[model samples]
Target: MEKNLAQKYNHKDVEEGRYDEWVKKGYFTAGDKSKDPFTIVIPPPNVTGILHIGHAWDNTLQDIISRYKRMQGYDMLYLPGMDHAGIATQARVDARLKSEGISRYDIGREKFLERAWQWKEEYAATIRKQWAKLGNSLDYSRERFTMDEGFNDAVRHVFVTLYNEGLIYRGWRIINWDPEARTALSNIEVYYQDDPGKMYYFDYKVEETNEYFTVATTRPETMFGDVCVVVNPEDERFSHLVGKHAVNPANGEAIPIIADSYVDVEFGTGAMKCTPAHDPNDFAIAERHGLEKPICMNPDGTMNALSGEYEGMDRYECRDKLVERIKEEGNLIKIEDITHNVAHSERTHCVIEPYLSEQWFVKMKPLAEDVLKNQNDPDQRINFYPERFSRVFEQWLENIEDWCISRQLWWG
Candidate 1:
């Protein structure tokens, strides 16, 4: 009490004391590889992040398992690393420069990327410091970054080998585009929200007839590239116009009425506009009809030349203009605001624009087949937590798309 020099809790005083002791005791070091081996890789965190609650929880669990393995006298390796999250890291650096009143373009790509590497080094140092605090028994001596030369070489080697095997390809495909990032994203990166919006109805004149059929759609602006109108072949309602075409409500472009099983007979009058350039399902229909797939928007979700007067405008703005134009043409139908799940880019957080673009992809059918076969035979299978997630895993494997693997950015 005289000096207030000694505290009741000496944890802080023993901080450096405990860490050095643990490391010196070889608790953090790996045993000889000759011993019965045990290894658990510490999941690499995104380079753009600091430790959060989820990281804290996850690392805590890993630490417990590693400690138990060491006690069991197993040679162990818990290697630590960071994932160079391309878009996320780029966005973080861009944001930092924005605060400093500078732009990446002003600094040039090499310089900007050098700055990003600096940020990564700082964060890596902090991560090492934080992991120390958490007592994670990760082998920092062998730490790796996903973007390091050796890792990059491995990535390139895999890519080249897969491409040579025809398991990789580049082609025109329908993809969910991130406008703000101007990049093609894998389907897994898309997040959905229930959005409240109106579906617009427009009248289409039947070719060689004065009568017109109305279509109800949530995305009216995509009418710019309508190649056809689709309905179920068994749909008795539109059977009369089955062999004919329709005059586009706004552009007067004639598009044939085609029957396809993809349409659900009960949804929105059972009549759907086929805009191959803007919808995935419609792209399939276009291929069937040998329709020319002209793109109406850029990867960044801005209007392109196919949009005519709406060219260069943002997609939502063009949507408004298209609706107004149809209204003026006396072909506009009623609109009702409704809630629905809208998909957005996970990186840019912009509404996902379905666009036709050239991109690199991975053929996944064989990979999925192997996963499914293993999953179906439960005796020799991996696992899922909570039990319910097992069904989700199975479902995902069943419907896995060809993975889009390219990014316009350099750090991927």
Candidate 2:
């Protein structure tokens, strides 16, 4: 007599049990190196998150390919892994510590990293359990983590080789800085949002005369760092003011008035205040005119001593107070409501500051050139899906900028 089958398959009863049995027998592991080989490397997931639907879907796709290869009698190696996640994980741990009324600086970098590792270990086990429920045949015995000693060693070797080949170097440049995290971030890590703010028009008085020229800015707080006032070389109204100097409103320091064709005649006031240490375009202008870069804010986004009486105030706080000071001094012409895109940190949600810092960068033009050349070869070695993506990809490579690689966080 045939036994009656259960009315319904119970996931709670069989899922973990079946996965445990498969792992016990090493069915997911590669054996018999002589067999035809098939391998799929799992995209490492950040340790800061748990098993989400997106990860379940991705692993399911990898499982299909792995299972198909196994059915064809090939030795399959589907390796699973997780990343230390660097800034993201560090930020998570920081939030946790803050909830407990402690700080990373309270315990020091070594102890802070110990907490991060503990977090990783606890979360990793939960991730493996969730992954097991999905029934993906990953090689559990060979699972890897990016911060593992073996992986770290491999990374170091690659870095040293690139450095020896002159592909890596350090230089001072404008970077997106997260004031809350107190670290420099890559361009991709910043989120830009359209924000409603005011554009301020202020007058810069000629050092030795009653003459004053109007300039406009979104961030009046950066006026403390202004080293020069720039006008278009052909702007007839201000051509006579070129090569003279103007007195800074925030401080009594005298700054040069330079003429450059890079100025936009139609923009507010037809004159631009050049804050070399605070803005990228201003930095370029300073470079062309050989002016000094005076940093006005600390890494934590507070005004520094260079900002005169406004030192120790928060950046936004200083902006409001500085505007009031300008009004009292009769240098403020007007304020206009404006909507502009402002960058914010993706992790901390604080506004990003255009900071001039020395950071390690990789020159990208050489690498982009190789990719562009290879894609256009007659042999057609690389192909693009949807065909239209080829043009977009080419344009991106053509205009690629130097990549910032260093992060100031304690985690990997």
Best by lDDT: 2
- lDDT by residue (tens digit), candidate 1, 192-267: 9998888888888898787888899998777777878888999999987887988887578888888989999998
Q: How does each model score on lDDT?
A: 0.84, 0.89
Off by over 4 Å in 2: 1-3
* lDDT tens readout by residue for model 2, 1-412: 8998789997787664888889899999997688999999999888896879999999999999999999999999999999988888888999999999999989999999999999999889888988888998999888999989998899889778878888888999889999888899988899999999999998888876769888899998998888888999999999988888988887878888889998999998888888888788888888888889888999999999988788999999999999999899999999999999999999988999998999988888988899999997968546788889989989999999888888888888
Q: After superposition, how far is residue 358 of candidate 1 from its true place, in Å?
A: 1.8
Deviation from native of the Cα of residue 368 in model 1, angstroms: 2.0
TM-score of each: 0.89, 0.96
